[model samples]
Target: MAETPIFPAIGAPAPDFDMPASKGRQVSLAAMRGKPFILYFYPKASTPGCTTEACDFQEALGALGSTGLPVIGVSRDSMKAIDTFATRQNLDFPLASDATGAVTEAYGVWVEKTLYGRKYMGIERATFLIDADGRVAQVWRNVKVPGHVAEVMRAASAL
Candidate 1:
């Protein structure tokens, strides 16, 4: 298991990362520093909740982008999985595969979870909002997909 940081504290610098993107490009958090960013970490690519979240963001792409806040989805799945998920769903934003769990750990979302009373390690679905000055604007951990992007937007709009 990777070493995950404690839950990212709001008002701090968001932990930095550079992971493999679905488009074969490795994106660094630094590259997105000048604009608000939505960095969401999910369990895996193409899974039910993950897909719903991705699609929700996809459907809200225009609205979100119009606000100048880009969304980036992260997961432990491979780039192939991300590619298939994006093509199949026609997702407009980038999806990064955190196959090594480095980014997950950095954000503290790779955690122990319980399902049917069986505890195991998995991602705790979460989202981070980084503001233009590279500060951690907000952190949403243990998130549910429904209405998440809207919540992020609501928060970002106030930033």
Candidate 2:
């Protein structure tokens, strides 16, 4: 049996992590203190759903940033793959690589998934809204791509 990872709850400090991201830099929750940010976990890069979600976020970047929130996408893909995805999608936000899955585990987005009777461990689409104090303000699990970015933008705007 797999132990269930403990996800951070609302009003609790978010689990901190540092991972390699595109543009040849490391992104960390610690560095984002004093600013609200969005941390969204997706299963893979360049896939249809993921692409749509990413592009939606990209399109709303201006609006989302108007609330002074930075957005980040997390995946277990390699840094090279993340770079390509960012470039191909013209993504302006950082997409961090969690090849070791540690960050995903900490965020509690990594879990066992069954698709067509085949079971595997992978990222479950989830999003976390962290407040300027570094505490989680909101969370969405098993996210659907459509209208999701707009919803997040609304939530971030209210923060």
**Model 1 lowest lDDT segment of ten:** 1-10
- Alpha-carbon local distance difference test for all models: 0.86, 0.93
| Prediction 1 TM-score vs. true | 0.93
**Mind giving the per-residue lDDT tens digits that candidate 2 earns over 91-145?**
9999999988888999999998989998888999999999999999999999998
Any runs in candidate 1 off by more than 4 Å, and if so which?
A: 1-5
lDDT of 1 by residue, 1-159 (tens): 345559778888888898888767677878987898888888888789889999999988888878898889988888998999989988888999888888888888989887898878888999999999878899898898888988988998887
Lowest-sum lDDT 10-residue window in model 2: 1-10
TM-score of each: 0.93, 0.97
Off by over 4 Å in 2: none
Alpha-carbon lDDT of model 1: 0.86
